[model samples]
Target: MDNRNMSDIIESYLKEILDQKNQIEIRRSEMADLFNCVPSQINYVINTRFTIHKGYKVESKRGGGGYIRILKINLLTSNDYLETMSEVIESDLTESEAHAILEQLYGNNLISAREFRLLVTIFDTKNLSTCEDLNKLRSQMMMGLLERLAYEELE
Candidate 1:
């Protein structure tokens, strides 16, 4: 709707499709009819936008029940995931939320029992029982610890 070129539109659509992990099966004639362009225009857009170099695989059938299938390549770099998790935990977390995140890290084999115990020691509320206003402080500290670990993992 913003007057983007055909390739941009196709690229955006492909991203959405990949996010949903749903295969696209558009008939060439139907696509051409919807876009009010020749079928070759659709071919050009598909070739340019859904290429393997851009992390996609495409297949097409040519008969009466023919359709196009696009598969997205999932690239999960460890450093990237770690960096992203570090950025995600920059905000405060509730105790239960922090425990859940810690569980996830444990389940993913990202941290050992000693590290988990250390984190629990660092975030335990027993040490702060003397303070009357430490409700969210534990959560903040836990988030800070996780963020630091994630950042360290990126290095």
Candidate 2:
């Protein structure tokens, strides 16, 4: 199987468990053995698929009896979620970072898929003039969009 498929399978499995438990702790070796993949593959999935931007907190210990813990953060309010997204934007926003934020917002039902796709297209910095500071521009644009959405939610 391709690495992407493996990552998707692992991510889905973890999300399923997390949905029930809200948190989970597991050993990397055990997950590797179960998936018939290298330990590093598990790390790859965890690092990319489960990130703070996606509303997950991951902690790990390294040793013979080490464990990796994944926690699903519950943002009780839209303001809290917006604050987290602001932190993710922190000073600059690359195309990929903007895409990640849109994906997270869409996944959390904060924005529609149509809105997500629109934002993704609009944030494409390649088409813009090289003289423009894409990172700073994108950061400002994303923050404006997110703030508008948050305000809409309140009203």
Candidate 3:
């Protein structure tokens, strides 16, 4: 299977388990064995899929008793979640980082499908090739777009 499929399977498995509990602790090697994949595959799934932007906090221990703990962060409100995301984007913004934020917002239902597509198109690196300072432009554009969307949601 492709890496994307493997990642999706791993992510789904973890999310399914997590649904039964607020937190889960698992050994990386054990999970790898269960999925018939390498330990790095588990790490890849955890790092990319279970990120802070996705409302997960991950902690790991090394050695014989090593375990990876995944905790779901519960944001009090949508505004609070948006505020937390805004803080995360504090200065510079990269293409991948911006895409992650957009994905998070869409996953949490904070943004609609149309909005997500529009934002994705606007922030696409290729679309912004005309800009001299890509990072700065991306940061400004994302910030402005987010602020406007937040305001619209408030109205």
Candidate 4:
């Protein structure tokens, strides 16, 4: 009895392929046929799951012989990735946004699993519910962590 939704299953299936390679190319119709789903369902999965902020680059070829290409992006230097992410972190952070940022860091190997879990705990909305200005506090805390990470990269 798997409670996972179709999108989760589809995303997991695609990620398994991505783990073996930096990129994957597949036909949309073929994917739908394999999964016993509609092409639009495939589109929805790709559109939401394979997003840029999630550190994925997606390109598609249209018309006959069309296919989708998903690439897991990598940076030559970790600092460059951190700098880009620093800019991406919003002034008022939401829990989902923080989770995405943390996941990106963990996925890129910039943060260890322990650090990721700790950060996730700290940034969880429930933990910050008592704060008067939760977003502001979370933003400042994340900025501090980002600065610490950047500084550690110098050593």
- Candidate 2 per-residue lDDT over residues 1-26, each given as its tens digit: 45568889999999999999889999
Window of ten residues with lowest summed lDDT in model 2: 125-134
Where in model 1 is the C-alpha error above 4 Å?
75-155
Query: How many backbone clashes are present in model 4?
Result: 0
**What order do candidates take by lDDT, descending?**
4, 2, 3, 1
lDDT of candidate 4 over 5-68, digit per residue (tens): 9999999999999989999999999999999999999999999888765877799989898889
Give the top-scoring candidate (lDDT).
Answer: 4
Candidate 1, residues 1-155, lDDT tens digits: the string is 59997667666765786789845667778877877778888888888666543345689999999988787644364344344444555345445545555654554556788887776565556766785555467656755655676677767
Model 2's alpha-carbon lDDT is 0.85
List RMSD in Å for every model shown.
Answer: 14.6, 2.7, 3.1, 3.1
**How would you order the candidates by TM-score, starting with the best?**
2, 3, 4, 1
Give residue 85's error in model 2 in angstroms: 1.6
For each candidate in turn, the TM-score is 0.44, 0.79, 0.75, 0.73
- Angstrom error of the Cα, residue 119, model 2: value is 1.5
On the 0 to 100 scale, the lDDT of residue 11 in model 2 is 97
Winning candidate number (TM-score) = 2
**lDDT score, candidate 3:** 0.83
Query: lDDT for each of the candidates?
Result: 0.63, 0.85, 0.83, 0.86
lDDT of candidate 4 at residue 75, scale 0 to 100 = 76
Enumerate clash totals for all models, in the order shown.
0, 0, 0, 0
